[model samples]
Target: MAEAVRHVQVIAAQCTAMGPLSQLEKAARELHDALTDPMLGGCQARTGEYPSLLIGDDLTPQDIDKAVDAVVRQAKADGAVLVLALLGHGFTPPQRTDLYFMVRNSTTQSLRSAVDVGRLITEAADEPGIDGVIAIVDTCHAAGGVPDAGRLAGGVRAGRSRLAILTAAAADQPARDMCLSLSLARTLKDGVPGAGPALYIDRTLAETLRDQVSGQVIGRAEYDQDPFPLEGLWLARNPSNIANAHADVVGPLGLQDLSQSVDMWRGPRRSPGRLTRSTLLELEKFISCGRVDDELDSASRAWVDDVVTALLEVFRTKEFLADVLAGSLTSDLLRSAGRLAGFPSRAEGTVPLRDLLEYAVLRAQPLDGAPWKGLARFVAALLHEAGISHVDPRLQEWARRLHLVTEVNDAFGEFAEARQRRALRLVVSLVGAWTEWPEEVDAWLLHGSADLPLHQRFPCEPGGAHGVAQAIGAAMMWARRELPHPELLEHVDIAAPAHLLARWYPEEEKVGRYLLGAKYSVIPRWSGRLDEAEDNAEINDAARKALKKMSSCAAAPVEWIDSDALLDRSALEYRLSTGQYDAAIGVDHSPDDLEEVLELLLPFAPIVLWPRSGTRPDQDQLRGLVQERWHELPDGLAAAYRHRWGAHQHCVACLGDIRTVWHDEGWLEFCRPFEYRVVTTPEEEA
Candidate 1:
């Protein structure tokens, strides 16, 4: 009898509803083409070879059921490995909720909910030839958020077989649509072996072969049944990793297998005294970059040890001091060197005390003025290594005085504009209690002496001593009344309270009003009283509001563009929710005409042509429109559109509007309406 036919199904179901469609079809077509190309992952087998089947279909209740049944039947009949690629909706709602998948059904014209997916497990548990199952879920569960580990673990348990469930995101993380699958496609077309370095995975055939070599080890673990000769199995985010796993699992398929030859796959070249000085130099660079991972190869670990030894030797040398002062060496490496400076400072050494404070200063100077603030926290680690008490009065004072918290805040602001101030607040909260701070820091937040530049700064608004008093009072009341520790606020001085209560500053009020009217407001809650837990969140919301107002007011008004009638209002609103508007328009302009609308929306916009259908756009016309526009788009936008537009239907903000356009391009140009403010000078507007 012929062996079970190998099967691969890459489901590019972008639709969360059974209504109008666009990118779902495109993704399906792309998956279909990928499956047909044998050079991709489709391989011919020997002796009753298992044939491969690729399924690219929209996900619906009925569709999901059929898919489940088809996969189960194929697994039983072929006794072959199975691969399922799912790209759609999945996420955890607020308050640690269960993640859910959106399954659509067109006959009923509605979305179906698929919870605790069980097809693969049921078939593996029931069949004979089926080696194992590999399932990949690339979608947010709810509100574009990932479920927690507890939920994923529970889902795995529900499968009840030799099953492997892999998600694109961690349980508590949200998944994003493939950001550059087409650009990756072009790279793949150029014949790059394995999957290109794209943002997401979609090599269906390779995944199938990968399953063949790895066998049912993952599923066996799930079933609590380990068989003989354990096969290698892995969960990876990159396609190249899967390809590497494939070669590792198969192991010398033909005459290539030579018993006498050395095992290159066993890791590194085994040679006596392999730790050379040259290798040690390279190791120093890697460690300084914070590239140390627990998953390093044996050779790598040995090399790291050698480098650590060399670093220690350098620190002991007088010549190293000159280099440190000249800004040629890093403080982090210097600290590491300091730790290794003593005879016991080598990789295997046990140095009790090292001058890490000096090390931090040295490192900070060279790294463009302490570029990453997280490195400052290494001081604590150095102290711990030296066996110093973290709670020591001297240590706490030192920690607070480092100004590392502010440094970290600045770093976060550099990384993300929307969350900049909030990130700063979080850093302060996290590291405020450190010991090394001067009394002047708190004194600045209180009353300051006249003519003293630092003294004029206060924790609350300027010239609002009353506001500061009110904030202190409210913080104390809330701590005493609502929080877990009433004495907490008492312990916390007026320098930095857990929360603050102050009347909205005029500028702040203006920003908030503009945001309150915008479709995608930055403020999370409009009417709620500010409290301790909500303080940071409130700040972020206010900043977002202010930014929008400033952007909108600064842009010179163009009379030709009708602000109210620009682009489909619903589509524009959807675009706003996804942060797409910010990307395409900048803070300068809005898309009021078809050309601008098409320019911004076409790249990632999934066309929903409306006919006689209720909410869904007309099917045939929509398909034609998308097919026609697919190749006409600009290259950059096309790449971006293909990457982020798929699998956004049924999103909380989507509201099942079929004729909708969701723009997710990173248009950071358009001035936002909430950013508007009265300015005294043109320079201020500029």
Candidate 2:
């Protein structure tokens, strides 16, 4: 028995066409052939009957709305993969130069205003089980085609989304219509679709089906009815059991026999094509579980070792070789290759590097750790293509060790608490390396710059500007490892991270700023006049007021205060620079707090120690005391501790201080930052 036929639908919108009329005619003809071709095997048997429509005129707002509504309704009911192709004239105004899709209605002679196509594509993503969608826009459209040209080719990115866009021009240039529409027609006629035949979805499907031949129904298996009018190519093929069931009967058939069958099937069959419900159920699985996954697994380390030797015997034979590669596949092959350089991890054994590198080239992650050398090199490739990087040794080493640091990082960053500690050690190790050896560490943070303002730079995510600053601080520390404190400070500035801390800490931004401004200014400091401090007594009084404010900030989750820890570190850096570390004492000393500040400020200071005693330990200790008091500390302070301290161990101790510390069956019964005197627990502490 041969494979059953299936149906598919397409909706092409040629909104902007600057190309010659011949080319548009050619594209239209090609689309028709693509839909009907039998030799090309393009059309699958669609369940619902709806003629594929190609709208070639400019679209107005009314047209756009109608199109969307119709498309949506059909999409909901038919549940067929719909492809819309746009080609036409378009231009962005000189004032607001961003290109938009130039849509027009059949009746409207003048062009309607441009609608941003990005929004449309985004909307399309929400449609369910739509399979794959391709948008081919050749116009002066902004997404990807050239500017002012009839075709633009640039917009659309690959992701979890099933939609793909191919632009005719770069963002800056107008799309080139030259011969594209005709070329597309000719391409479809010849049995291919993309950059070349190898890249064409139609060609790929042909190859997939040809490989499945067992000589039973050779020429009977065609994609569509004809080759001149292009349609969305939908492949229907025999299942493994059926194809192989009669294999013994057809096994002896060779290329010559297969070719003969192809010639015989060139004529129409006697049987009216009908798909069984069982066959439909199976076909559903096959299309959904396409060939991408097969290609990936075949190329995988685990599968390669198992199947390679056997496959080598059939490599030279087109029929066998094609069968080995055909079928609908998952996109995971690309994703996995992109992420790991195709290095497949296994519980059974290690994989070879050759396959891993091939995977890397396909996946676009740095192969062999080449990106860590410097920021310039790391970002150069990906800026052009998203989610691809070269292998950089240092970066690889860091990623490899992220697991260990994650644990402590979770407890400290106090972000989304309660998870396995993230790989904080790798970060620590990297910073240690950078502080210890600048020459050895060469890297650029491609996305976040350390120089940006704290508010602008730091997002709520842990990996935001704050993380980047910490990473830089670590790198600086590695560079200044052997230099004297003053010399090292001169070479590197802690201001970036420190200022972030000051800006966010509630007390530093509010009360602390108020008192400091009053004590130190003849006028507003930004207006530029400094007043001399009358005595240490006056400064001490100001410091105590600031301490009260700092205490308030330390009591809440660090996130509650809208400042960067880096700023606090920077302010502390100034104090250390002027021999005022003694004056700014009394703050938290949790593991999370210390590691965060150390990881944040260590490039500027060699030794950050916890205070033995002070009016305010969190205030005086600043960086150190925060590191020491890990378990009890809140969010931002906790993150600081993890970066500074290796890990948090031992247990939480509730000691009596000013206030009585009481526990109800191991439940904590006291607010933090305030002192406790009588310590009592109804149950044992962990």
Candidate 3:
């Protein structure tokens, strides 16, 4: 129902965690005064009761909710618009979606006693007989309230009032000051130069986003209201301006005609009246009340329901909403209608997902450019950013079949690109991959997409490089065929015993073409074996200490072991026992270096860089590269190897000279895929 908003009932809340209470209290007071007083406020003074103010260190979340409900009821009875402001610290709980306004005795771990912003919006919008509702929230995640508030716009509720929301948030992070609320109060008192007969919250929000309001903090506003042709419910009158604000050519600065002029006051920017998912699901209900539709049949309603279900799966998450509110959404993503571009438009505000579809179907707007894959594309992008990608190709096909109004990104193509972007390294180990250690050829099994290993037992002469290379090569080829693309296989890290790693394996794709080190990040690990070896519990304690030294900023610096000291194994072991080195870099390697220097260095030093035994190009270059690229760790070693590849372009065998070995016993235990052993009970066996 369209109601002419008269006076507004102001209800402002302030909750702070150990700070000066005066600033918050003053900001709320200025807002309330601007809404009630006539001269500076620009509104006629007419009120039966004073504005409600809920302020304190003693106020609980329950106190805030109860007070808001009471004020909303009073506003409904008086037929007045409600101006509700929430100012304080907002907390997003661990791994969960909801944004909670922290009050007395509130904690991040639990939110049973916190004031939910979405629930409060639902409360005000659902109240009957209220002329209008306007909410101003200033917190870290204030923009998160936009989608929920947009849902109640003339749909899904019998008591639908005109709803307008302007929620502000700091661009940097967790709001430290009351700049937003203070700026808002000051703006209401001192009206804009180009404003018309009335000043609405939309104009103020635009000012805030542009940083025209305050210089202390840069801000973004998530604004959405009922699609009014002219303006939203008036917050205050234009303080004192001409009957009509206009712009005329400045005769001194312009070369154009002197009489040329343009109207400065055109009112707030126009919106497409974007319909949200909540509105779409109950479009029939909206029609029965304020709107009418002759074309909305049973088939159409069923279609909308199915469409909403799919959209909800993609959009209904704290992660998605919060990310978008933080300006993560792009114009190309919402590129359904030509004019409908940005997430929250610089001029018109947010373009809800269902806006284009609603207009296309109901208003009979043209839908030629729209594609069905927009949602799929958006999901793929979101998943990629969050380090996730697990959408079924069939559901993507289903989206295409229904011909939903949005986009057309190839699911398989996108997934392939995402895998490459992730740069996932495959873990191909003889003992780890196989059910029965590495004895005979067995069937290959691939688990899902991405980092999961392929299992199979292969027959290879123990420590025979050629036979082992071929077995690993066969398994890799099988994995690429089963998965999306070969490029997704960034590199392979083989898990095997010291004997296998000691013998440099040749590339199976071409026998004697190049060595396995040409693969760059082809690392060797033995933690899997270490975990299975006797006295593993003792080994775990040493592993933790090694990890601590690597991660510590003040740990002993990396000291290179002298190649001449290779003959004195006792001296090397004694020097390492001093705890003066967190990492070990070898100048040169011999046939005996692996067991002598490496074995002693393993339990103490976490990072080890060495030249493979076959090639001895230059110890000086290896040492220089290690010194320059020590901080980058795994990636640095890969880069150094690539540089060496270029240096030894004339020699194919030397391309695989440098090898990097990273053994983290802590990480190895943490990522053990199967933690439980299968036991056959007697009753089950029978």
- Top candidate (lDDT): 3
Worst 10 residues of 2 by lDDT: 521-530
Query: Cα lDDT for residue 38, model 2?
Result: 35
Model 1 lDDT at residue 299: 54
Question: How far in Å is the alpha carbon of 202 misplaced in model 3?
Answer: 60
Quote each prediction's TM-score: 0.26, 0.26, 0.33
Q: Give the poorly placed runs of model 1, Cα more than 4 Å off.
A: 1-5, 14-21, 43-59, 91-97, 105-112, 118-129, 142-166, 170-177, 180-686
lDDT by residue (tens digit), candidate 3, 337-417? 212211111111112233322222222213553543444344444434433334445334444554531342454355556
The parts of candidate 3 lying over 4 Å away from their true place are 1-425, 430-454, 461-463, 484-487, 506-521, 527-531, 537-557, 564-568, 574-581, 584-593, 614-620, 631-647, 650-656, 664-686
Q: Model 3: what TM-score?
A: 0.33
Candidate 2's TM-score: 0.26
For model 2, residues 98-148, the per-residue Cα lDDT tens digits are 445554432123324554555554454345423344455555533432122
The digit string of per-residue lDDT tens for model 1 on 546-638 reads: 334322211110111123335355755464445332211211122223333433333221121111112333323233232223222221222
Give the Å error, residue 10, model 1.
2.5
